[model samples]
Target chain A: MSAQTLYDKLWASHVVREEADGTCLLYIDRHLVHEVTSPQAFEGLKLANRPLWRKDSVVSTADHNTPTDHWDQGIQDPISRLQVETLDANIAEFGARAYFPFKDPGQGIVHVMGPEQGATLPGMTVVCGDSHTSTHGAFGALAHGIGTSEVEHVMATQCLVAKKSKNMRVAVTGKLGDGVTAKDVALAVIGVIGTAGGTGYAIEFAGEAIAGLSVEGRMTLCNMAIEAGARSGLVAVDDKTIAYVQDRPLSPKGEAWDKAVAYWRTLVSDEGAHFDHEVVLDGAAIVPQLTWGTSPEMVVGIDGKVPDPAKEADPVKRAGMLRALEYMGLTAGTPMQEIGVDVVFIGSCTNSRIEDLREAAAVARGRKKAATVKRVLVVPGSGLVKRQAEAEGLDKVFTEAGFEWREPGCSMCLAMNADRLASGERCASTSNRNFEGRQGQGGRTHLVSPAMAAAAAVTGRFADVRTLA
Target chain B: MKAFTTLDALVCPLDRANVDTDAIIPKQFLKSIKRSGFGPNLFDEWRYLDHGEPGMDNAARPQNPDFVLNFPRYRGAEILLARENFGCGSSREHAPWALDDYGFRAVIAPSFADIFFSNSYKNGLLPIVLPAEVVDRLFAECEAKEGYRLTVDLPAQQVVTPDGTAFGFEITEHRKRCLLGGLDEIGLTLLHAADIRAFEEKRRADQPWLFA
Candidate 1:
């Protein structure tokens, strides 16, 4: 038999039909929805006068624009209120499987909640209206983001007509150094392959370094795969994946669980599987990484100096570097550790899991927030994660260190809510995307891992977590 | 959906690289799900000098004289010419919606992020991928001549300047057909409704527990 990559295996099994033009009608096992993108999609369904094809497969939530502070006080922003209310109405009318509204125990970021409830499973195709839907691929599911129009298409048809993506395997070899987390590996990969390098490919993370990551770590790795311009990122189903899924709230049980695991065990690529592109990284060489510029690709080691735009040969790249430096208030040759921050944000879909909180708490356990830092916010990805953190006293540690413990939502990541950075306020953020005004209008965001953000919170600068230890 | 057969319109050269969606439509303007009102807020941060909130009268906002869109010569332009990696962040279909709403029928760039490229086509906005040198040439021409116009013939897959210089591009036949026919994807999928129903029935029996 010919060799098949894991992506090919997953694509073939879910394809209902392949057309002459190379587009395949792929079956979607789960469809996740959030407030910001679904209203127009639901309106499309109404215009077509069609019912949802598979209500049982859809889960809806209000996350993107939900305020982290005073969420129960009722969303004060009228526009945000309308968007969230629209989702509640759309779900009720469409007969969605579950709708986690604001203040619900399960309410949180859609990508984070999907895996926690086991709606995302191995060998399935999961999709959401938001791009970070790639996060669910950590469960070995073929997951990716869809545009709002495609969201409407899926809601109406329960399928997506997608082109089969080329397979690329990024193998991280060697053992990771101390204080180097999965977030570091992700940043390292993005640094190696510039933001647009993975375009039109579905990446499979493989090899020893990947094998050592926990499910949460793998989720962090896959979460940023979109930042690399790959819509989907995957890791083959392993014991860690199975362990994470087994006995979860929505996972199959008893005989059904046995049948499911049996199928999942076969989800790995063939022994001689071929990939169209391969990138092998020496994991030992990676240090704690942080983005110094606007793009995810503009990263350096925590101790590295800021790059001078004059050194950049490409005129376009040089212009970008100059703009970023001016906006970020950074100077050429300034070490990252000397860059002071006005705020520290340590949670997002990328790093708000329990494991991420534990890592952050370890660094913030016995420290006080630097006087130079005006504010620090620690938000969990989901209410469940928040409760779990409080149970383990991680929340207490954060609050004791002058960090405000906030409710779960996509807060400060994009800052759609009121919790936003004022203009020119620099932040060491654990969220993805450092694009101009991503956190707020005229605000500057420096992307880092949760541990790095926590360390920055205590030190008021981009401090390497290893040095603090 | 509007049929996109050909477009002959004035070109606005946005000489920038990696023009992300956050810049295309800022986060503050993302609160509305209606999708129609985003035209005024397109490039909100760059186009206006003051902060823009929802329900604020766009006409009252102070226009940034430095922005390309505010220049009188580029006014009423329906085509955009830009540098590489345009529309590089977020899967907000609103980015394309804002362009379409603002009367842009096509975007010609050296390259585009995949999701934005896909979203552009789906929203009846033609995104033309030209070589970087060709894009640079177009940018130069647009700057040198005010109200510079380009004629894009979708069927011919070519963009022709006023001086008759032409640059050919490529598009998948499937996408081209959908655009030419003004076909709605949901309506087309409904044609296979019976087959979808049959597949779902068989799938349920094969994995009954999945329904739970």
Candidate 2:
């Protein structure tokens, strides 16, 4: 057989048919749904009088609009309440294979819940309406986010008409320094390649550095692939991936487990497979990165100073830098550590896993939050992660440091719930985007790792965690 | 879904790059289960001074004259002209919904985020990608003329200026067919139901745990 990249192999396995045009009808192995994007899709199905093609292939949860605090009281916002209610009604009517309603023990961010339950598997094709669905690609699945219309199409057909994407390889080499992490590596990659650099390509992250990361760490790396403009990012399946999925609730059992494992071992790319584009980065040179401007590309090392717009040669880029600087309320040439913060948010689909919380708890142990820091929140990605963190006493360490250990939901990341930044509040966030008013109407966000956020909570400013250690 | 064979519509120049979905329609408005009402709040933060809560009368709100959409000249524009990497954040189909509901039939940008580009075609909104220089020229022309417009001829794959200068563009034959026919994706996929069913049966036996 000819050499094939991992993505090419996965794509070929799922294709039902290739049309006269470039589109192919690819079968979906798993379709995950969330509250924010699925309502309209169900509504479309109702309008068209269509039945769900295969109910067993779909799973859902209510995450985006759920209030992290007062979970027992139910949703307070009228619109948020309606969205959750709509999902519940749709799940009942359509008969989804599984549904984790708000406040359920299994309820969490869709991306977090999928992997934790083993719904995402190696060599499978997974999709969801939320862009972070790429987080499932950590398991070597051909996963990506689809629009609501595509969501409706998947709901009705159990397949998607996908156009093949060019393959790119991002190879990170060398050992990571202390206090650096997958979030740092991801940020470093985005920093090297601008926000739009990965457009029109499916990136396979490779090399010794990628092979060394934990499954959770790999999820963090792939989760932010969308921020780099790539719809899907993949890491080849290995022993670590199989081990992580082995004992999960939905994983195979007995003789079936062995069969699945045998198939998964073949999911890796052949040694001589060709990639359309290649990027190589040195991992040791990377430090904990923080976004200074609006775009993820506008980043600098933790100890670096804000970039001067005057130094920018491109007029369009210069304008964006100026806008970000003005909106973020930072002066060019000022050290990033000098910038004070009002809130420190250390959760989201990106960095809210058990390992991420452990990193933050290590920094927060025996340290109290600074007087200038008003609010510090530690939200795990899912209820199961929350329970695991509590069992390990990471919640206690966080609460002692003045951080509120909230329920697992997309709290304050997009500010769909009551947990939001008031206008003009500056935050150190572990969430993906830092667009203007993303946290709130006029709030500012700075993206960082969980440890970095924890350090910011204690210092009330952007402090390098390396110094704290 | 509306078929897009040709449109001679006024162009609105939004001189910005990386305009994210959150800015297209803020998170507060996304709570609605319904998708159609987003247009009035499209670019809500930029277009209005006061906060836009659900059910608030859009007309009653104070409009920011400085915002591109609120300007008198570009009020009813059907085409949006923007810079590179437009729609770069969250995959809220609401971004295209808000754009479509706000009376826009098409968007022209130097480049577009992948998911947003796909969503636009599915929702009957044409996202045309042109070179940065061509986009810059269009922006200049729209700014210079009070009522500048472009005649988009989809069948010919050309955008013609008022002076008769034409710029050619390219799109996949599949997307072209869908846009021209206004074909619903779900309906299109249902036509291949037998193939989908056969594929699922094979998958069920291969990975029984996945179905469970």
lDDT of 2 by residue, A15-75 (tens): 9878887799999989998988999999999999999888877889999999988877888
Model 1 chain A: worst 10 consecutive residues (lDDT sum): A15-24
Q: Which RMSD does model 1 reach against the true structure? A: 1.2
How displaced is residue A157 in candidate 2, in Å?
0.5
Cα error, residue B57 of model 2, in Å, equals: 1.2
The segments of candidate 2 whose C-alpha lies over 4 angstroms from its true place after superposition are: none
TM-score, one value per model: 0.98, 0.99
Model 2 lDDT, residue A407, Cα: 95
lDDT of 1 by residue, B1-212 (tens): 77899999999988778899989998877788786878899999999999988889999999999999999999999999988888987989999999999999999998888888888888899999999888888888899998799999999999999999989999887789889999997788778878777777787776665777
Off by over 4 Å in 1: none
User: Which whole-number lDDT from 0 to 100 does residue B74 have in model 2?
Assistant: 92
Error of 1 at A51 (Å): 0.3
Candidate 2 Cα lDDT to native: 0.92
lDDT of each: 0.90, 0.92
* Predicted complexes: DockQ each: 0.72, 0.83
